[model samples]
Target chain A: AAADDLAFHEFEEAANLLAETPDAATTSQSDKLTSQEHVAVVVGSGIGYGAEGEEEDDKTSLLQDEKPQPRFWTFDYYQSFFDVDTSQVLDRIKGSLLPHPGHNFVRHHLRNRPDLYGPFWICATLAFVLAVTGNLTLVLAQRRDPSIHYSPQFHKVTIAGITIYCYAWLVPLALWGFLRWRQGTRERMGLYTFLETVCVYGYSLFVFIPTVVLWLIPVQWLQWLFGALALALSAAGLVFTLWPVVREDTRLVAAALLSIVVLLHALLALGCKLYFFQPLPLDHVVPAPQAIPPSPNVLLPSSVQPMTTF
Target chain B: AEAEDSPGEQEATSSKPLFAGLSDVSISQDIPIEGEITIPSGTRAQECDSSTLNESIRRTIMRDLKAVGRKFMHVLYPRKSNTLLRDWDLWGPLILCVSLALMLQKSSVEGKRDGGSPEFAEVFVIIWFGAVTITLNSKLLGGNISFFQSLCVLGYCVLPLNIAMLICRLLLLAGQGPINFMIRLFVVLVMFAWSVIASTAFLADCQPPNRKALAVYPVFLFYFVVSWMILTFTP
Candidate 1:
């Protein structure tokens, strides 16, 4: 399908097609960036997070290029995350265990500005625990079926490598981008703070910690059952943070968004577990209606045929 | 004790970022796009100058990657993309359309095996019809947006559908549950509203004030049909 869309019209040519819109020709404001300038100044200009609130201090590495390069992840580098006003990030940490960190996030940093330092570590920590649990999951699986020799697909080394990047950075970064995009979609423009969303997610992932106990159980169905329940707790945490932000303006919208957020949080957590941790021996992409027959309650259309499970 | 308490008490109006000289927003925002730099022909410099050029190139690539990431963000939120999109490229819309198509295809691969698969052609025809219908309606109602731009906006607006489709598909992994039904209901409903809000927001720049409501009806109906499909077709 994607190949076909590419055949139908290349995206760049489509750009050329619209490269001549009147709006394209003239952007006469200070922020209106020409094609070249867009690349040049986008870094210095804050498009999303507290664009006006922070100052830019260029890190001229060459001033001491000959000087001994400090080991990366040095204290100063870690300190950069807290360079911004952290009363909010601090408040979030204090309120982190609770359901609603958004209030502190909103009051301290506003909805737009969030300190990622604390949230980043919080997520990283959970990701570490998740990595450990993932290795344990294979062990438990093998224990259940002693007669069936199972060569573990995921060694500890590979699992560690993944969690190091995934939980610590990639997941958080993806959430940050998605949140920024969502806030941009909304009228507030800055309503859902970048750090606030990250903070919510960081804490939300905490649900994975207790859910790690799911690894102890060898029963496949039970592990999944526990996984869903565990992820639901994380989802609830996300909603708690999200609720206060949207509730005042639009109750229905807030409720609606909270549901999506919860669902997403749960899905992400579960998906990560299934993909990374639960190395189920039975590997097949069983499309719907193949594995499980439709329940008696499920009334199928006349055209649809139900198939039995494997 | 007094001095320590003083700093804590002075939290009144401190607007500076938490660390002094630490809140430089440019670093993470810089995405590395250029693998390396090519000096202009005949422009040769000493080793030192080249290193600085290398540093500059590195910084530029980072900024470029950030800029590209920002562009993608714009695709997700076209209303915000208004500025980033001036140098319109097919990347954003193509990404969005492909993502939606892939997600729908993934969700309904089962239906395909069983026949009645609304694969690429079916999905494209639906999107094309919806986008055109709204574009025509908008034009009649005095919207100034060009057809291609509407296609671009309308195409990107399906992002919410992609998300909703993912949620629905993921829920199917859990099999039939009464609670699953409710969760799907809530997800599709929000995504429906989100898709509508996004499309309407994108069209706001083009629609006339008096005729805006009329212009939005078809847009709403188009999305309503899409949302209805997402809701009814549970794989």
Candidate 2:
């Protein structure tokens, strides 16, 4: 019933838009400069791209019923586990750089696709890097103390990949959901706009990308410092993209929400540092050298035979 | 092409920034976001074009050899634009299976002339069985893919593992040491990791998320076992 209502509303809106479109088009040529900006914004905010060439017919009865819906995003978008699309993955890497000060790349580029294809895939790949590098750090730590046992997560390839992929997807998703719910909208914003938030959130986490290789530094203090920097950058990138879009009346509410986002990044970076970028012997409770004395009885001469009993 | 050539200055002159008063930020209207630009432009996967399947198998080995080779290399990017997946067929898999069998034949029985070697038999049985088992698992687990499609994807995804095996065989000649052991271990681990990722990219298309993972797990284990074999291979 709601779907039918929505379709009806869409049709009615189209009719009204058609009626207005003629006048809009008549002025549109003169208004092209101003309207171009509006078109980009409309397209950027997830409304479909402005179709050209049929402006006059579209103003009449071109709105027959509905068009071939891309149904681009599944109801869940990237919320589905089975979802995977390489183009979506590539788009996201560009999406992460929404902070770049140039042609409004985010609004321009992201206008292309309506779906969040493989946020999990991007997260998982990064997690895979973190897993391997974390394992490498563990090896370095173990060299410092023979007794240090590595996390069992690295014991199997699939286990580590899935563990990293699943967790990476879950944490960001939870954060995105929290921010959206906090936005005070019950009827979710239009699909494209909603996914832009999701994409921006996923891409901002690319701040953690450096940690994949930086974990090899093997210095505890350096790793901690890098982790903090990554957290700040990731948090800042998100805030920048999200800042303009926050409802004009509720700027304070958005600010409050953003601080929490910063906190989430802190927690994420700390989690990565503790779980993934552990520095050798820095946080663990290692016994002092003096605790175990070199007992003469146990310390036999080089020629003495070793005990064979198990 | 015309739109892409539009002036960057126009975007600068016309568009207001996302935060208008804050800065002079602007976005070009002509920028093509990939999904919108690329996906529709791609050659679509043929839906059960069985009549051409046999002919494609021959062409895959004969005329389409270079294309198949390029697709094998695309395991790295796994881009949606790869025409191999778009024009999905049996030839890619047939070439892969045959070449892989030949590669394993050399590795499994490099020093032995024994015709009835168990390693040869094991490779033969396991490759087909692994492919069939995965197809059945996907079918039973509610995957909406055709049997041949699954077979084709499974075969292509093994390219990395095949490359890893070849690398291992070459590294085995460098004499044993901690460095050699570590390098081999790293390669195997990464290849194992890539196999899981690449396979899931093409093969993970079922519903009821948990079931998809269940179906994928066996493929993961199968690749893991293959990597393990490569890691342990010694002359």
User: Which one wins on DockQ?
Assistant: 2
Tens digits of per-residue lDDT, candidate 2, B1-235, equal: 4124334432433333322432443547697544212212122232122123334566545556776767777676675543544556666666656665565553334345422222555565656677887776566444667777777777788778777877877887789656997999999888888878887877675434535655676687567656655664555
Error of 1 at A108 (Å): 7.8
- For model 1 the local lDDT of residue A240 reads 57
After superposition, the stretches of candidate 2 with alpha carbons farther than 4 Å from their true spots are A1-66, A70-92, A98-106, A142-192, A247-251, A279-310, B1-147, B156-176, B182-235
* Ten contiguous residues minimizing lDDT sum, candidate 1 chain A: A55-64
* Model 1: share of real contacts kept: 0.00
Model 1: per-residue Cα lDDT over A64-83, one tens digit each: 13123335565333222332
All models: lDDT? 0.51, 0.53
lDDT at A41 for candidate 2? 30
DockQ of each: 0.01, 0.02
* Chain B TM-score for all candidates, comma-separated: 0.64, 0.64
Return the clash pairs for model 2, or none: A103-B26, A104-B26, A104-B27
- Model 1 chain B scores worst on lDDT over the 10 consecutive residues at B35-44
